[model samples]
Target: MTAGASYHGQPVIKAPVWTWQIPWYFFTGGVAGASAGLGYLCELRGDDALARRAWAAAMAGICVSPALLIADLGRPQRFLNMLRMFKVTSPMSVGTWILQGSAASTAIAAAHAWFGLFPRLARVAAPAAALLGLPLSTYTAALVTNTAVPVWHEARRTLPFVFGAGAGLSAGAAALIGADPATAAPARRLALGGAAMELATTTLMHRGLGEHGRPYSQGRCKHFDQAASGFLAVGSALLAARGSRSRTAAAAGGVLLLAGAVSTRWSVFAAGRQSAADPHAVIDPQRAGIARGERIGGARTEPVARDAAAPAGPAS
Candidate 1:
């Protein structure tokens, strides 16, 4: 099978039904997760002011994430149904639980930071929230790769790191806004590291996919992907020079980093949709697998059909 060939010249696999809401949900959840970790680190370092700011960022993301998820679910009521079941095998179930726990923990940490209430309990809650943030940051990548979509599934190993880097960039950028230069230094360094990691992983993922990555480099997705890489590169460079330059330069870099993070997610989603819409993207892998003698049952076993066409005798 090739991209030019299709069933009745139509796509074999349907494009994913997900919309912007899902990507936004991913972005917000990721930011929330990273912010929680950043806040915890600040607290451990005894920078209460910086920690409060970081927690505020986490709170902002937490407030918006559920709305995005519910909007993606199409009905607010459907969101409740997600909690009605708990299945270990289902990523969605696991994600729902993670989100619920993260929300509660983050809320407590944020409250403690702002009001100074629950001083005894806050100590426990802050670190717990940060611990929960670890999985919260990377689980969305698992959710994406677990789907049947070829582009996402093929990059399963790399996507988690990519998303983690993106989350770090977002959280760091958020932390830098309105923060003192001295306090923001750590965030700037973190964002720089994130940009570097994102670039490296993205390059490896593209090379790993080879021809299968065409959709990401072509058409609309191509523009977004290129833009994301460019912005991240420039932003990280500017941030690296923050010591020599004014705070304005670093702030601009932060904004650009955030843009790059958003663009990266959007591009991935768009590329996956393109891959799913192309019939050959789904069939070619199976054909290649069959050629390599991989087991494909039922209608997918083309070699079985070929062998069945051979002439046979009935005597034996």
Candidate 2:
């Protein structure tokens, strides 16, 4: 089967309604979640300056993430509807509550750093933000994979790690850019580990996808994925050499890691969209299921009259 082939005389797949806003939301939200946790780690290490910088990054991400989500929803009012009720089975609903908690706690932490207003509350708020951050960093993977898209669904087991690693890379890059060398050492280590994890999980995801992974490795999607991989590799190398090199090199490495993180989110979004638009990508799985004696919903076990020359009276 080819990308353009039809199934049962009709297109087996339809294009996804999601747009660029979704990918941006995923990237920013992941960054915010990881940055919040990184800030708490810095605080625990007694690095107030670096902690403040990480909190600032989290604040920035918190501000942008909602706007991206609203834009993708295509109506400012629709976001309110999402908060009307919570469903445990719905990743989006759970994510909405998580984002709310993360944003409020992060905002309070940022306030204490930026002003003397919440000095006493900072200890509690900061830790709470970090706790919420754990879920925020990984829930987007659940949200994406919960959909009907074949590639996203098939890669479900590995997507969370991929997204979490990307989030760590983004947060570490933000810290490296904003903090001093001594304070930035943790960030460098995080970038190194995140780069390695991202590379490994991405490889595993694609391999697990089998033929369904073709969309990710072909055309424009391939370019984005390759670029992300290259950037991550170079950034990791530069970060490793930071002790022997100038801060300028370290900063450049951070920037590259940020680029790679954003590109990776974009690549995943595009590949999922492409997979949804290809008929073969949707049909082949069901065909395999049928071959294995699995009863596919809405599928006929017997040939239709139109497909057969005559209908059999009865089966022996």
Instruction: Specify the highest-TM-score model's number.
Output: 1
Prediction RMSDs, each to the true structure: 4.3, 4.6
Compared with the true structure, the alpha-carbon lDDT of candidate 1 equals: 0.83
TM-score of each: 0.91, 0.91
Local distance difference test scores for all models: 0.83, 0.85
lDDT of 2 by residue, 1-316 (tens): 5444465555466667888889888889988999999989988998878888888999999999988888888677767999899998899999999999999999999898767568788879999998999899899999988888898988889999999999998898888874567657888888788889899999999999898888887877899999999999898888787722467877888899988998899899999888887777888777777778885445556654453666653323
Clashing pairs in 2: none
Off by over 4 Å in 1: 1-5, 243-245, 300-316
Q: 12-67 in candidate 1: lDDT tens per residue? A: 77788888988777788888999999999988888888789889999999889888
Residue 259 accuracy (lDDT) in model 1 = 88
